[model samples]
Target: MSVRHDWYQSESKVVITVLLKNATEKNYAVKIGPKQIHMTADGYELTLSLLHPIVVERSSHKAFPSKVEITLAKETGERWQSLEQKPILVAPTIQTKNWDRLLNEEEKAEEKDAKGEEALNQLFKKIYSSSSPEVQKAMNKSFSESGGTVLSTNWSEVSKEKVTVKPPEGTEFREWEK
Candidate 1:
């Protein structure tokens, strides 16, 4: 299906807004890379190969009731002639990201702010949606049995035994009496 979107840019950042009617966090997934973006929601998919490289670690996105807004930090302040670059004929099997790039003061400060539980939940949903049936089963079984503390994608291991609760360090696991 077709995706409706609009984009605008400043010297250092580009913002893309994808219009998705009645879009919720459960129904959408957005993956951003240094030079590409992939968004899928409610049977619609939008992929963009950016005209210029971006600082992947500095990019951010937010979802509203009607749309998703993506903000990408440009590698340099130079203006981009267009949003999308020409499509490359061959797609690379592996793309490497340089996470060790020196962060500026602002980026370093932003890193201190935790993304919180909502982002973690969204990540798990994305993984569950994209995984195979066996993996999904394992995840569901393990998560349910372990009091939501464990999630495993390995069907062979999870199927062999019932997953026991293993709480975080310094925390004890307990079963409540009926």
Candidate 2:
């Protein structure tokens, strides 16, 4: 569905009101994340990567006959001038020969999997060095169990030691460690 959003911000919260002209209250699904949003209205998809992250658990939405309003609690007490990373985002109406034809089931599944993995990796890498001893041990154990591969990792402040994972020269690793 072709849509536009009006964003409002306060010191502690941000609200987004999306106008979907031909949409109804019962025909849309919205997914909110820390720094992302995904919605499907009558099989039309709209996705956004937010400029600033918010408290995902505190976000909620309300649907009107022709619009949806989303409220997000900011992670900090700061006002924001913009909500999305892009300035001119036009919510494109998904193409469909029939109502359900525009649904991207496969792409949605792949994106969910990729986002989950990426978020986990980012969280681990961000706090690995500063984490408590128990957390560190847990992460290491988890990684070891999964055989996760990081080609090269440098803990610069932790003595500049680099851990490298290299397969034999002639080997071509093509599959994920499942």
- Name the top TM-score candidate: 1
For candidate 1, list the clashing residue pairs, or say none: none
For candidate 1, lDDT tens digit of each residue in 40-144?
887899999999999999999888888889999999999998999977688668767555654555576665544555578789999999999999999999999
Q: Which stretches of candidate 1 lie over 4 Å from their true place?
A: 88-178
lDDT on C-alpha atoms for all candidate structures: 0.89, 0.72
Each model's TM-score, in the order given?
0.47, 0.44
Question: For model 2, what is the error of residue 120's alpha carbon versus the real structure, in angstroms, after optimal superposition?
Answer: 74
Please tell me which predicted candidate would have the highest lDDT against the true structure.
Answer: 1
Query: In model 2, which range of ten residues has the least summed lDDT?
Result: 151-160
- Lowest summed lDDT across 10 adjacent residues in model 1 is found at 97-106
